[model samples]
Structure formats: structure tokens, C-alpha cells
Target: MKLAWLRSLESAHQDCVWACTWVPATDRSGGLLLTGSLDETVKLWNPEDLSVVRTNTGHCLGVVSVAAHPSGRIAASASMDSFIRVFDVESNNTIATLEAPPSEVWQMQFDPRGTTLAVAGGSSASVKLWDTAEWKLVSTLSIPRPEGAKPSDKGSSKKFVLSVAWSPSGRQLACGSMDGSISVFDVQRAKFLHHLEGHTMPVRSLAYSPLDPRVLVSGSDDECIHMYDAEGKTLFSSMSGHSSWVLSVDVSPDGAAIASGSSDRTVRLWDPKMRAAVQTMTNHTDQVWGVKFEAVGGGARGSLLASVSDDKSISLYNYS
Candidate 1:
């Protein structure tokens, strides 16, 4: 697979852009890109030309994560203030405002079937699930503390969850934490299955291969990306090239390549088979915050990848 720089929008937001997701196409509109920033606003863009479609405001603090429902009709954005806003993608109408206090929200994702939304609960050391139909809190998958740690032990906070991802089949969920361990859980049983350990620093991002449910990829503050057998609980390989923290990582829809954004100010595309970076794009002058592949749909739009950075810019690329 190869990536060709397509376009970029400078100053897309007033501050650092931290999160982005693809809003699938609907009958009334084609697929659009949604991005959130430290500026406290979420903006929708027409990828065809990287033009602004709409800007959503009212987020209290820097937006930490953004997720799109499978139906393409709605999307959710979460901020550092611990609030989640679920709204209509087209009309921008508010659907629901969700929060689980004392459980700060970090990353969020909707299940493949769109029945539930899973959020990474920081400090609480758990993953919170919300029923989409009623927008009600359904379950909390708390991480098990270490054997010698007490419930009130200060070291337990080291497991503060930072990112969450769902397996393609939606049967399993994985959450990454500040201490670098990843907790895998069985969604149907709502039980913790196992923990995958390798990185020594905070794991800031996680993504499961869309084509392989067992293959999971993670980026960490240690400046490396590790691929794991999600179901088998084994480390497949580790790739290191970034000079600074790897902020975000995403597997291509075709699963042929993995893309990562790093604080080193570059976006690197990796060949998972070779376990090495094949190319790096260095257009952004600051830390890269997020990278995402467009989830395929019935529309004829070609394969696309997007990256946002602390430089207040969004870059688009054609992936083939």
C-alpha cells in the first residue's frame, strides 16, 4: 500500500485538533470527516475538497475523542470536562448528553452493530458502556487491580484508561491504560478476559484491524507501536521509529497497512507484514494527535486517510 498527499487545511481550528472520525454517507449527503480540537468545537469537512461543511460548538473543554455511529445518521464527541454529546450528523440536533462522573472520558467508540457505545474511563480504570437506543448507562467493565494493590491504593491509578477499541466482530473490547498494559474483555459476558503487557509507557491509542479481529495495534508514549494477537493474548511484533511519543494509530480498512501520528511531527505508514515503516509524511510542524482511515461504504469515494496535529492543521491523503 502507498499513500499520496492529497490536501491540507491550515488553521482548521483555533487550537490543536485532537480527534477525528469518518461520518459515513447518507441518502442526503456523501461521507464527511468529523474532527474535534482543544478549541472546544467539532467541525465537519467535505473530504472531496477539504472544505468546511459545518462547525459544532458548546464543548466546555478540549475535545478528547469523537465517534460516529454505524448508521451514519449520528455522531458523538467527548471533552475533557467529562461530558459526551451525541448529536445528529446532518442537522446538528442534540440527541443525548452523557456522563459518568468521577470516571473521566478519554476515548470512545460505537459497537459494530450500533447498539452500544464504549468509553474509556480514566482514573476509574474501567470501560463504560451506554445503550444507544435509550442513551442510558448499561455496564462498566472495570479493570482488575494488581494482586497486592488495595482498592484505595494510590498506585492503582497508574491503570488510568486512555483509549478503547472494539474487535471487528464486536464480541471483544480492548482498552489501553497509562501504565502501558492493555485489558481485553468479552462484551457478551461483560467480563475481563486478560491483560496484554509490553510497553513501559502510557498507551495513548488503540485500533483493531478491520480485516482481522485478532490483530490489534497500539501506539504509546514510549515511541513504539506494538501489534498483538487480541484473542490469543500474545505480542505479534513491535515497530519503533518515531522519535517522540506515538499519539495515534489506525489500521487501513483493507488491513494491508497501519498508519500512525506521532509527537515527532510526522505521520508514518507501516507495512504490518514487514513490521517496518515504509513511508513517512512530515508536513505537520507539531505533534500529531490523530489518524483515521475512512470506513468503506456503498459510495464510490476512493480510499482516504486523515491526520490532525497540534499545529492546528488537518492533512488528507489518498491511500492505495
Candidate 2:
């Protein structure tokens, strides 16, 4: 693996940077980077120089998730307020607002076809699907309460959905919950499939390999990252080394490596087959919350990685 330090932005966020994503390249703009933070703002950056393009405000609580539509024209952000804001990516204008009661919002993703948006519902113990065309909620795919559990039991909070992912084909959805369980759903039928179990701590982040719909990666409060065969229902491997909570995990666009950020103030690069952390970047002064690989684009050959930390900074790295 090849790596290089690019640049670091101090005070990129007032609090923690909780999420990051690469917006696909468009004719009018080079690929952009989108990030959300506990500061209650979503920011857009020009990836080449790590310059701020826009700062979107309105989220009542921490902004937890930012997802770009496949068209590169729109994006959505979900916050602790349990609201989803759909907006024009280029203009930063609000297109729609989706709200669900009591259930908090964590992670979100747009389907490959951009026909729908899936959001992980926190305490609500469900994933909310919205129609892209009308910007209206279409369904709530809930995780069933555990067997023999009392209705008044706070186990529902444990089932809080934290991260959501869409398979490459957009036919399936997988969401990681606070209880350390991952639920798979058939998107077309809006039916719950099966749960993938292994992690005993909260699964904070998740990603599906771009090349394989069956491959899923997850990071957890257990300080380990897990690789799973979603369709096969198998736990392929677990990589442990982070000294604190593994705040986020993302697969490289090339599908060859996985990157993770941790509360241990380190960013790690892992080789799946070896099931080990190949590199640990210790440039952040506080807990690192988000890590993501840049999508390919203009003047961008090797992959670019962005990390946000509790120190209120964002760092960019070159991964070739």
C-alpha cells in the first residue's frame, strides 16, 4: 500500500466530524467532498485543495450522516434531531425535509438508481425509506423486538439503527444497529431478511464493497472492524487493534482495502485477507470519527482519504 500526507485543516469543524462521502464527478464541478459534524452543519469541500465550498446550517443537533445521490446533483443529510434534509448539491438549497418521531437519525444513503433514500433510524429501531421523486416517506422497515423481551424494556434503544448501506445493485439494504446486529432487507419487497451477528458492542459504521454486493464491513465500539458476507450469512474475519471505539469504517472504491477511524485518535488501513491493520495514522489530537475514500475523478488518480476528528480538524491523505 502507498500513502502520503496531503494537507490538514485545523478547525474544520467546531466539534467532531461524524461523517464523510465523495460526491461523484459532474460536468460542472470536479468531484467534491461532503462532511457532517457534531457542530450541527454539513460542509462541502473542493477536494483538490481541501477548500470550503459551502457550509450548510439548519440541523438542530449533531449532523451524523451525509450521502450524495448518484446523479451528483443532490445529496441528503440526517441529524440527531431525527430529520433528513434533502438538498441540491451544487446550490446547497433545501429540497425537502423528512422527519420521523422519537427515532433518531444516524446514517443515510441514496439508492444506486437515486430513486429512494434509506436512513437508519436510531431509537426508533427502523430504517426509513423515502421516494426520491416525491421526497415522501414510503416505508419504515423496523427491526423486530427481541424474543421474550418486555414491551417496556429499553432494549428498543439498543436496537437503535446507526449505519445504513445499499448493495451495489440497490436491490438490498443492510443497517447496523446500536445492539451490534446488522439487519438485511430486500428493497423491492420492503421485507426484512436476516440479521448478521458477531459484534457484541455498538456497530457505529458500515459499508458495502462497490464490487461485491455480498461483502460488508463494519466498525464497532468494541474497537474492532468486522468483514461479513451479507448474502452468505458468514463472518469472514475480524480485525482488532484500535485502542478505543472504532468510530467509522469504509471500503476503498477499488475494494482492495478498508479504512477506519477510531476514538483512539488513529486512522487505520487494513488488508482484509490478512485481517490486520497495515497502517495507523496518528495525526489527530483527539478522537477520530470519520474516514472515507474519494471516488475517482479529475486530476485524481490515486485514492484520497479524508478523516475528521474530535479535535475539530479534518485531514486529507493520499492512498495509492
Tens digits of per-residue lDDT for model 1 on 66-95?
A: 999988999999998779999999999899
For each candidate in the order shown, give its overall lDDT on alpha carbons.
Answer: 0.92, 0.87
248 in model 1: Cα distance from truth in Å? 0.4
TM-score of 1: 0.96
Query: Per-residue CA lDDT of candidate 2, range 282-305, in tens?
Result: 999998888989866444557899
Worst 10 residues of 1 by lDDT: 146-155
lDDT accuracy of residue 11 in candidate 1: 98
Per-candidate TM-scores read 0.96, 0.94
> How well does candidate 1 score on lDDT at residue 253?
86
Model 1 per-residue lDDT at 267: 98
Candidate RMSDs in order: 1.8, 2.0
Which regions of candidate 1 are displaced past 4 Å?
146-155, 297-302
